[model samples]
Target: MVGLLGWLISFFVLIALLVLVVYQLMCLADLEFDHINPYDSATRINQVIIPEYVTQGGLFLIFFLTGHWLLALLCVPYLYYNIKTYMDNRHFVDVTEIFNNLNWEKKKRLFKIGYLVATLFLSLFWLIWSSVEDDELGF
Candidate 1:
């Protein structure tokens, strides 16, 4: 039961993070191609960053509080990175510095997308298998 609940919550939060990363990725591409002004691009990216942090932090916190230790443990590294960036007050990209950091920013988003996809798959696999198992047991 706890496993089902953990995976279910993880599934939704992972979906949300995937969307955020992909959106950030699109914004980075546009900024790179001169399709969007640096100010607007930075602003958009910054807009998403806080919510991403909050949502991600909330996800892991929920896991920990709910006794989903494995899931919480899996998320610790990223959470720690997020905390480090926050503590350094460098979590958001600077508008004037956008051009200089474009490649690095894109790579970061790509890495996040990769990580989120991997976690998403794990949650999805459990969700599917659990549902099928439940159906088999007629519960």
Candidate 2:
């Protein structure tokens, strides 16, 4: 029962992360066409960034401590990149600086999209493993 609950939470958290990354991608694409002002685009992307990391960091702790060791390990590389970019002061966009960093920002978010896709796959694997374990245990 507990294992099922943990797997569900992890799965949904991954889904939520996926949504945020996709939104960021859309905002970046819109900015390319001037459909949205740079300030608005940067602000929107910036707003989602922190919450995404916080959720991911929390997910990491939950996964690492709750016996989802493989998933937990998979979270580390991206989380480390998050921390590194943050410490280097390169993650956020300033309204004045947005144009200068637009290309780099897109590259960064693209990498995140790739990471999220991979994470979703591992999460699905986790679900499959959990389902099989539950069946064996008669849960």
Candidate 3:
């Protein structure tokens, strides 16, 4: 059982994660950040922005707080996806026509698929871990 202090901390972290998600949504909608210089192609804000890190990290924290170690292991694959997405977007400015024409929509779909796979893996691992733990305890 998590203490009151832990619950409060988790709640605050969840709120912060929600705020970041909203900010990312605003960026995606192109309804803000009009002041950024278009000529400065070097600083691609979108390329540096991978919002899943926050969401997935928040979920991992929640799982850890709930003592779901096996489920929390999903963070590994989530981090991998985040790094891959960032790298794909960062080098997207390459002069090669192939790199320049990278499809962001497809990348997003792939990330979503990765997240889903991680979720499935987490569920399966958690189930097996719990069953093994139960057997060890003579359940």
- Across residues 85-112, which tens digit of lDDT does each residue of candidate 3 receive? 6667752333233223335533553555
Model 3: which ten-residue window has the lowest total lDDT?
A: 91-100
lDDT of 1: 0.87
User: Superposing all C-alpha atoms, what RMSD in Å does each candidate have to the true structure?
Assistant: 1.6, 1.5, 8.6
Error of 1 at 51 (Å): 0.4
**Local accuracy of candidate 1 as per-residue lDDT tens digits, 23-138:** 99999899999999999999999999989998899889877887768778988998998999999999998999999999999999999888888877877887888788877887
Candidate 3 segments whose C-alpha is farther than 4 A from its true place:
31-66, 86-139
Better of 1 and 3 by TM-score: 1
Best by lDDT: 1
Candidate 2 runs further than 4 Å off: none
Residue-wise lDDT of candidate 2 within 1-139, one digit each (tens)? Answer: 7877888888899899889888988898898888999889989989998888888898898798788888789899988988887899877778787778778888887898888888888888878888899999888
Residue 69 local lDDT, model 1: 80
Higher-ranked by TM-score: 2 or 3:
2
Steric clash pairs (candidate 1)? none
Candidate 1 residue runs with Cα over 4 Å from true position: 1-3
Tell me how candidate 2 scores on lDDT. Answer: 0.85
